[model samples]
Target: MSDTVDETASGAATDPVLQRLSTLDRFLPIWIGVAMAVGLLLGRLVDGLDDALAAVEVGSVSLPIAIGLLIMMYPVLARVRYDELGHVTSDTRMLGASILLNWVLGPALMFALAWLLLPDLPEYRTGLIIVGLARCIAMVLIWNDLACGDREAAAILVAINAVFQILAFAFLGYFYLQVLPGWLGLEQTALDVSVWGIAKSVLVFLGIPLLAGFLTRTLGERARGRDWYESTFLPRIGPAALYGLLFTIVLLFALQGDTITSQPLDVARIAVPLLAYFVLMWGGAMLLTRALGFDYPRATAVSFTAAGNNFELAIAVAIGVFGVTSGQALAGVVGPLIEVPALVGLVYVSLWARRFFRDAPSTDPAVPDTGATR
Candidate 1:
């Protein structure tokens, strides 16, 4: 329930956004890199480390991985202000754009890219589609905040996406992996996964954490107050999400280190499509919202929301559905790895693009103008 993290980020930016990050959050890529190295070394040097880690299992998930997955997701989900779902629902323009961009365009774009770019690599392709389907719940808030986007709007969009994900991710997984591929004459996933199977995994992994987060926020706020529950409590637990992410990454990479290290080109191959997806998604979202006359903050919020993926859930589902050594899990791990820097660059792009919006002068880190859009 309590832990501390040194928030960190890459590079030196005198911008307040960069300064706001703690050493831990700032150095996320570095941390993941180190974890990858440690895992690879462990896997390479220690004969039975992977086996030992995988030996203990619960409900088909290795105990260590299960712990990491839950710890990784719970805090992030708890931070989402689920009760505030109504706050931005009234903004039809913004909401519509986000819905189209996130649920429709976002996943479709990833599916196209994965298949088009890595047709020969079904594992990576399926993994990319899973990454796309997971959508952004936890990380988009940070990216939006970093870009000085709307807080309430970010929360609402993230909350909405999380709710839809529990129902839609599996169906989308089934569609992209099975139905769509078959229609396109592409080779489907080797594993015969079903919608219910994916749904069950989603329920256990995302549903448990989602419900736990809801109850925690509700009870914590009722017991204390909003300020204590958020300001006092959330920060302590928040760091564990990344820490848990790193823990799982280490184990996952450990299991597949030989493959990852031997075929460095595979990571590169995975990275190219991902890089294109982020840039295209973010840039396209920004332009679309701007064309729709959204203010800078709203545009930034919507753009980041559209661009980021829920890699935690994606990794969980990939490993759950495809097994740890599967390339799908490896591809899932590469998501946030590439996303971190890509979105950071887009933050600068967002800040720079402010001039294109009429509300450029209103770009302030606050709750945003809550006037209900007529």
Candidate 2:
């Protein structure tokens, strides 16, 4: 009976159908969108999402909040191969380029775009800048891997961004608050709770995952091969993490659904600056990568690093500090709506650009000529 049970389990685990489903697991970004659409549709049909959010709470924890943190951790932990840490120091140039673009150029462009275009909507303007300062802690690594980036380079860049954002984001938040016109009183209020609260959220969201990842590698090394650790275990966690995250997005959207519905004008209010930020950063990264003579993978990494925001962390922090009723929280909720789809498009663009750099490509190759003789 034991033998039969083991056989059944193994067969299920190795099923070809399951392997195919695993591909879907990798595309969590798409699932995230689906979750959002479904949640919004549900919220619309029902009265409001507030009760749903309230129902999801457990003690100090909410299911949505738990899911958000999980999503951030799983991606980072899965991609972090401790053996590859040695490679980071070697690929300093690519890492340097990513840091310069994501930290310096990305934040600066976002600040300018928000400042210039969103002066009227101070809360959302602050939210937009928060999105910018946070950088791409999780998604850019996925982009790097998809684009066939040097993993070492990508890891180094992610680690650096994670650390710097804690410090830089607080300062950037203060800076944005200070510069906004005195007429925008929301800035002063946001400035009051901003830095310290964000600092704590950073600690909870990033610190725990990082430590867990490191410890998991250290302990698991003796018991299992790295392939088993990654392919067998990490793959299982990927889908779960993404689903959790999207569910969180749903709750967040639901929480703000009524306000969003009532104030349709807010959509138009925030759209301009968000659209402008996306275009400017994407264009700037592509141009800068070209100027620096980076290959396709490195270029793709840079472009995404600049383009993507740490929306998971942003939403979690925004909700925690700014009330769920606040426009800042609403803006954080809106971020992934644009970000997920835009990134999928950017992934395709990166794949398309791959052909320019080399004769043979890893993902998809150009068709070879065939005679009509067949």
Candidate 3:
């Protein structure tokens, strides 16, 4: 079992598509920084462009960003094998732990960190809470695969998070941003958040892509066969999400370039809690996996999934609930900039941690050892 898993993972790691993706992930921070610089430069050179883009809004959501959001989310949602979600019931303990970590403990931790770290910066705090509320759905798969984690388990978790986000994100956003701050006696600005508005944003951002992805995969596979869809079709379109991500970042920073440049400290302030949140969540989840006696692959999957946030959804909702030029949106823009490098570093840490559990037995029969000591 372990050898078969090792062979499969090794083959995947060497595949051309994954290699291209790995190369992209390796220089992700550089790409983001370049995007920021380009956006700032454009913002300075073309004074009217930002205004023009900002003007194209419907119900607070920027049209260009909305398009980018849909493009970014579709590839991710399309890649998810929703049928595998049934496997979640077979591993109830892991599923329960993941849910607890992602929805409950994860959000609570970010709320505490945002408050503890940014007492005065209400907008930035709200941004952190928004990120916390939106759990991982897309990027965790890449992180998990890199760490030799159980891909099936990762897929199940991704599906679960996606469904949960559609259901709970708005209410949690309201609770944490509106009610909790008041209850905790923290000074908060009057955030005009409507549950219906948030629900609409989720539906537009996640729900539509989800439906489209489901239909695309179901129809495409039925027509062309699963092998061709997985190998040929998926690789061709998978990079669309990353492209959309970079475009969104450029547009976001282009819109808010002046604010970011003038108040550099504010960017740093938002980054601090975000950095802390990633490390804490990764560490906490790693320890939890160890406590649960999961093997290295399963442990890495749980830890990476818990550590990474669904920044795409967070950014969309931030722009929708707040405005494109709002400070909350700026903070949302800053999240992926901080997260990619941090999580990549944690990927290396996970590799090292794998050595410690290399000989440990897997609690779940579904996960094989994988001999993943690369």
Candidate 4:
């Protein structure tokens, strides 16, 4: 980690959080916009990458998405210090808030919003809902880390939510579409959620990387010096992950660029529900953290718990389950389009709101004082 990152991770006010926010504020939009353009251009250059993507699979899982998720996840795992998990877990308030916001509240709110707003667009409705239910597992950690959240709290929440999402993703899809009429579709809904299939993919995409991260951390402690790992390996994770993400984005947009080019209107339509979802999630999280008396890091974790979406997992699952041709797949693709920008915005909001809770009493400076846990 850089000196800037160390300060932010240490919870100092004059850390990378402010600088990152400032840099991202100035550069992210341009880079993301450039990403969109270059992605489209590069995406077009390789006409059959999407079709080639179809062949790269492990059993029922898609290879591209699996690889992408792994690349996206491992870097995050590299950043996690399991020691922090113990320290952060001791502060129950932050932990409790993180769990509730991510597992329970985030999915429910997303399902409800997608149901209410997406019905009119028959082609895209289910996809939108699926994307919504698949609340962010990895990027939330990234954003939380960026915002100077309690690392342990964020990691625990990430680990727990990831476990649940794998087990529940397919069931949630079935229930929301076929089983639960109020949340989304009615009797006419005929969507199939492959619980086992999703679980397997989760294993490959989430479980493997997480296990690898744990092993690396454990082994690195005894086999290698902490200084060597942090100094040589940790610093590289940020750029490598960023590169992987951009590459993944390029491939995804390339796969969907034709569709996007043909239907410019779809962008606006998808943006509406996504925007609303982010806004509602942010406001709800802020209120919940405040009402719960969460201190800074914990509240920020809760805020990101709601704010981020695992578009990578969602897209992969959508494609595997619904077929690439379905609108659900399209919705999953649309997720990153909206999410990248929205998360950046949420990061800003979390940082700006830091002053409000900075001095509030808490058990640990590392952990926030959300009332429920601590």
Index of the highest-lDDT prediction: 1
| lDDT of each residue in 38-87, candidate 2, tens digit only | 76666666774567666764322355765565564554464566676775
**TM-score winner:** 4
Global lDDT scores for all candidate models = 0.73, 0.61, 0.71, 0.66
Q: For model 1, state the Cα shift of residue 227 in Å.
A: 3.9
Per-candidate TM-scores read: 0.72, 0.74, 0.76, 0.83
lDDT of 4 by residue, 9-57 (tens): 3566555345534343335556666777776665567677656765767
Q: Worst 10-residue stretch by lDDT in candidate 4?
A: 365-374
TM-score of 4: 0.83
The pairs that clash in candidate 2 are none
User: Cα miss at 147, model 3 (Å)?
Assistant: 5.0
Scanning candidate 1 in windows of ten residues, the lowest lDDT window is 365-374
Candidate 2 residue runs with Cα over 4 Å from true position: 1-32, 45-63, 142-151, 179-190, 193-196, 312-323, 358-374
- lDDT (Cα, 0-100) at 216 in candidate 1: 95
The residue ranges of model 1 lying beyond 4 angstroms of the native Cα positions read: 1-16, 56-62, 72-83, 119-123, 137-159, 166-191, 295-301, 310-333, 340-374
